[model samples]
Target: MAENLNPSRNMCSTNLSLLLILLISSPRPAISRTRVQFLPGFDGPLPFQLETGYYLFSYYWANDNDVRKALNVRKGSIGEWLRCNKSIPYTTEVASSLEYHLNLTTKGYRALVYSGDHDMIVPFMGTQAWIRSLNFSIVDDWRPWLVEGQVTGYTRTYANNLTFATVKGAGHIAPEFKPMECFDMFYRWISYSPL
Candidate 1:
């Protein structure tokens, strides 16, 4: 779904999506709860990539419009997403407020943050600002690991049970960039079998 996201273009949107994804996706943790965060640098724009800003700007700008596309969509998607999503109307304030609650107010939740060095939407550096401020518990040393070759980065497990990772070369769409690696991470996090 997130194909055009550049690493350095839409830090705000990218970081927001990554944050929400970590909070929202149904967890199947055989081990424990985990949250994965994506990094987007601070300042005006992202690092190397430049299209992210435009993508976010356009998304917000046209968030309310019907925006009729000429392509065919799966049946249920049109009813729930295309038509309904536009109806609910998610404003920047709403988005930000949700983030605050998920990141700070929620209880007993764990997160695993990851980023792609090549992503332009949320540059790795920009993502660090908020993450550094998190004051989360860190019990493990950050280490380099590869999922799919393109989805390789760092892993930091927190004392309270959060696990953060950075996927190599992935942008907003980490799965597309490195499906195997993403799966590996998930499987490991959800390791229900005896280790």
Candidate 2:
């Protein structure tokens, strides 16, 4: 005797197979493209074509010359002025200071790790994750840190004398974006005041 199969089950399977085949063979929807004339960090309209599989590169002066002039370093000084070039060969390598941080914490050294909330270069989320990985107990939970009665940012403190903070409305360069807030935060931290 031939094995019996449920008719409804067979029909459902056939329908599902057809649906899958249709889905697989169907043409994908067109991808719409919009030309972005300007970007946030960039000054004016972009000069290069913005397209798929292409990256735009921008380089900013590191301001080492200004620092050298401010320090009044002699032209023929024996010690070379610090080079602020970002083109160091090993910069792309994966580097972590977690061990050093742990060492410092064990030695009872206090640390403040802050991030700009609006920073695109080194995002706050990544900074938070790095802090979390330290496995330090929270001494103080998240709270808004204020400056002159205005909430400047949020901060949290850990058991190992480590504090993490986010600067409100700041970008990659937090001090440049919010100098007063940064200064206040720094002053409070250095003075051993709660932020």
Each prediction's Cα RMSD?
16.1, 23.9
lDDT of 2 by residue, 67-163 (tens): 3344455555634322344544554454778899999997999999999999988999999999889899999999999999998899999988999
Report the number of the highest-lDDT candidate: 2
The model with the greatest TM-score is 2
TM-scores, all models, native as reference: 0.46, 0.58
Provide the lDDT at 24 for model 2: 41
Worst lDDT run of 10 residues, candidate 2, spans 53-62
Query: Model 1, range 45-156, lDDT digits (tens) per residue?
Result: 3333321322233333233122212133333453422212446756564534446635543475655566666668788776665565566656777777754444267876
> In order, how many clashes per candidate?
35, 0
